[model samples]
Target: MQGAWFAFILTLLAGLSTGIGSLIAFFARRTNKTLLAVSLGFSAGVMIYISLVDMLAEARLDLLGQYGQPGEWLALGAFFAGIGLTALVDLLVPEVENPHHAWRVEEMESAAEAARARKLLRTGMVTAMVLALHNFPEGIATFVAGLMEPATGVAIAMAIAIHNIPEGISVSVPIFYATGSRRKALLYSCLSGLCEPLGAAAGYVFLLRFVSPGIFGVVFAMVAGTMIFIAFDELLPAAHEHGEHHHAIGGLIGGMAVMAVGLALVR
Candidate 1:
C-alpha cells in the first residue's frame, strides 16, 4: 500500500509540474527561448540516453532471462509498437491544431490579439487533449517502473517533468490569451496533468495483477520507445524552433551527461 501511494505521489508531482509552466506563462516577462530550447534538447538527450542504455538494457535482460532469445525480439517489437502508436496519434490530430505548437504569452495579451488567439486556442486545446492521452501510458510506465525500482522511477519522473514544463507553457499561454482567463488556462493545464495520476491509478488497479518479470520488461521497452519518440519527434524540433541550434545542441549534450551521471551514481 505504501509503495502504491508513493508511486501515485510521484506520478502526481510529475503531472502537476505543468502548473509550473502555467505560472511561467503568467509571470515571466518574456519567453526565454534559449533556455526553453536547451531544456527541450536536454529532455531529449536524457530520454534517448535512458531508452538506449538503461531501460532497454533492463528489458533485454529480463526478457532474455524469461523467454530466452525469442523474448529479445518480443521486447524489440514492443519498442517499435510504441513508436507506431505515437505516430498514429500524430496522424489522427489535425495539422493546424497539432499538439506540438508553442506560442508566446505576449502574443495573446491584446484585445486585437483575440482573432489570432482564437486559432491558437484550438491548437492549445487540441494539444492539451493529445497530451492528456499521451500522458496516460506514460503514467502507467512511470508507476510500474517505480514499483519495480524506485531510483529508475525517480529518474524517469524527472525527465518527464522537464519536458512537461514546456507542454504546460504551450497549453496555458494561448488559452489565456484567447479567453483572457487565467482560471480557464490553469484549469485546462491542470486537467491535462491530472490524466497522469488517473492513468497510474487505472494501470495499477487493472494491470498490476498480471505483471511478471517478462511483462514488466516488455512494457519497459515500450515505454522507453515512447520517450525516445517523444524526444525526437517533439522535444528536439520544438527546441530548435524556439531557440538557437548551438544552445539546443549544448543542452542536449548536457542533459545526456547529467542522465548518464545519475544512472552511474544509482549503479
Candidate 2:
C-alpha cells in the first residue's frame, strides 16, 4: 500500500506536465516550433513502442491464463474497443480550440491589437477542458504501469510528462493573450493537467479487479492505436505546420531508441 501511494505520486508528477507547459508559455515570447516538433514526435515514439512491446505482451500473459486462445482474441478485441472509444470521443467533441494552431507573425500582432479580453479567457478555459479530456487515459496508464513496475512507471511518467508540455501551451497561450494575465493563464493550465492525476486515482480505485496481463495488453493496444491516431492526426500535422519534418522524425527515432534501451534493461 505504501508502495502504491509512492507509485501514485510518481504518476501525478508525470501527469502534471501541464504546469511545465504553463511556465514555458509565461516565459516564452514565441512558440519554439523546432522544440515542439521534436518533443511531440518523441512522445509518440515512446507511447507506440511501450504499448506494443511491453503492455500488450503483459495483457496476453494475463488473459491467456483465464481464457486460453479465445482470451487472446478477446484482448485484441478490447484493444480495438479502446481505440474506438477514444476516437469516438475525438469525433464527437469538435476541436474548436486546437492548441497546435500556429499564428502568423502579422496575424498575431493584429490579433493582439484587435481582440478583447473575454475572448482570450474563454479560449483558455476551453483549451483546459479539451486537454483534460485528452489526458484522462494517460493518467490511467501511468497509475497502472507504476503499480505494476516502479522503474517502468518512471519511464512511462517521463514520457507522459514530456507529452504534457504542449498541452500546457495549448491552455496558457490563449488565456494570456485574451486577458493579459500571465498568472491566471498559468494557473488554469496547471489545473487542467491536474485532471490526469484525478483520472489516475479514480482508475486505480476502480480497475484493480480487472488488472490482468491480458487486459493490460488490450488497453495498451488501444492506447497505441489512439496514440498513432494522434501522431498522424495531431502531432505530425502540427510538426509539419512548423516546417520541421526532419527534426520531428529525428526526435521520433530518438524516443524509440531510448524506450528500447529502457525495455531491454528492465527485461
Candidate 3:
C-alpha cells in the first residue's frame, strides 16, 4: 500500500511538472534556447540509456524466468509493439497540432497577431488534447517503473518531467496569445498534464486484476520501447532545433554519464 501510494505520488508530480513549463513561458523574458536544447537532449539520453540498459534487461529477466527461451522473442516483440503503439498515436495527431512539435517562449510574441487569434486558440486546444493522449502511455510507464523499482521510477519520472516542460510551453504559448489570458493558458496546460495521472490510475486498475510475471515483463519491454521512440523521434530532434548540435550532443553524453553513475551507486 505504501509503495502504491509512493508510485501514485511520483506520477502526480511528473504530470504536474508541465505547469512549470507554463510558468516559464509566462514569466521568462527571453527564450533560453541553449538551456532548453541541452535539457531536452539530456532527457533523451537518460530515457534511452535507462530504457535499454535497465528496463529491457529487467523485462528480459522476468520473461525468461516465466517462459524459458521463448521469452527472449516475446520481449523483443513486445518492445516493438510498444514502439508501434506510440507511433500509431503520433500518426493520429495531425502534424500541425502534435505536442511534440517544438515551440518556444519567443513564439508567444508572434502568436499574438490579432487576425490569427481564433486559429491560435484552436491550435492550443487541439495541442492540449493531443498532448493528453500522448501522456497516457507515459503515465503508465512511469507508474509501472515505480512499482518495479523505486529508484528507476524516480529517474524515469524526472526524465519525463523534463520533457513535459516543453510540452506545457507548446500548449500555453498559442492559448495565451489567442485568449490574452494567462490563466486560461495555464489552466489548459495543467489540464493536459492531468492526463498523466489519469492514465496511471486507469492502467493500475486494469492491470491489477491480471498481474503476473509474464504481464510485467511484457509491459516493461513495451515501456522501454516507448521511451526509445520518444528519445529518438521527439527529444533529439527538438533538442537540435532549439540550439547548436554540439550542445545537444554534450548534454546527451552528460545525461548518460549521470544515469550511469546513479545506477552504479544504487546497484
Candidate 4:
C-alpha cells in the first residue's frame, strides 16, 4: 500500500513537470534555448536507456516464460503498437497557435481580454485538454512501473518529467501571449498533468485485479516502446529546433548513457 502511494506520487510529479515549465515561462522571459536543448537531450538519453536495458528486456523475459518463442514476437508487436498509438494521437490533435517566436514564457500581463484574447484563451484551454488526454496513459505507465520497481519507476518518472517541461512551454506560451494572463496560462499547463494521477487511479481500480508477471511484462514492453517513440519523435527534434546546439547527437548519446547507468544502479 505504501509502495502504491509512493508510485502514485511519483507519477503525479512526473506529469506535473509541465507546471515547472509553465512557471519558468511566466518568469524566465526568454527561451533559454541552450537549456532546453540540453534538457531535452538528457531526457532522450534517459528514456532510451530505460526502454532498452530495463523495460524491453523484462518484457522479453516475461513473454518467454509464457508463450515461449511466440511471446517474444508478441512483445515486439505490443512495443510497436504503443508507439503507433501515441503517434496516432499526436496526428489527431489540432495544433496550437503561438504569435511570438519565443518558445519560453516571458512575463504575465493583466487578464483583460479583447475578442482575439478570448480566442487565444480558448485555444490554450483546448490544447491543455488534448495534452491531458495524452498524459493520462503515461501516468498509468509510470505509476505501475514504480509500484513494481521503485528504482525503475524513478528513472522513468524523471525522464518523463524532463520531457514534459517542453510540453509545458508548448502549452503556456501561446495562451499567455494571447490573453496576457500568466495565471490562466499556467493553470492550463498544470491541469494537463492531472491526467497522470487519474490514469494511475483508473489502473488501480480496474487492472490491478488481474495483475500478473506476464501482464506486467507486456505492459512494460509497450511502455518502453511508448517512451522511445516520444523521445525520438518529439524530444530530439524539439531540442534541435530550440537551440542551434552542436551537441545534438552528443545529447542523445548522453541520454542513453545516463539511462543505462540509472538502470544498472537500480538492478
Predicted model with the maximum TM-score: 3
Clashing pairs counted in every model: 0, 5, 0, 4
| Candidate 4 lDDT tens digits, 118-172 | 6666766776777787787788778878887788899889988987776787678
Question: Residues 1-267, candidate 2, lDDT per residue (tens digit)?
Answer: 876796689868876777787777666667777887787778767766776676666666767777899878876777667677767766755566655453222334345567677876776687688777777766776776777667667777887788777777777777778877878877888888887788778867766767654555565555555555555566666656665789888877888899999889878
TM per candidate comes to 0.90, 0.87, 0.96, 0.87
Candidate 3 residue-wise lDDT, 116-169, digit = tens: 889889888998999999999889888888877899899989999999998998
Descending-TM-score candidate ranking: 3, 1, 4, 2
On the 0 to 100 scale, the lDDT of residue 121 in model 4 is 69
Candidate 1's C-alpha runs over 4 A off are 107-124
Candidate 4: residue 44 lDDT (0-100)? 81
Could you give the C-alpha RMSD of every candidate to the true structure, in order shown?
A: 2.3, 2.7, 1.3, 3.4
Clashes of 4: 4
lDDT of each: 0.80, 0.71, 0.89, 0.77
lDDT of 3 at 236: 94
- Give the backbone clash total of model 3: 0
**Candidate 2 regions off by >4 Å?**
100-110, 209-229
Alpha-carbon shift of residue 201 in model 3 (angstroms): 0.9
* TM-score preference between candidates 2 and 3, better one: 3
Clashing residue pairs in candidate 1 are none
List, residue by residue over 1-267, the lDDT tens digit for candidate 1: 788888888899889888888998889867778888888898888878888898888988999999999989988998888788767766776675555665455644442255686786886688789778877877877786677677777877887788788678778877887788989889899888889899889878865678766888887888788878888988888888888999989988998899899889988
Please identify model 3 stretches exceeding 4 Å from their true place.
Answer: none
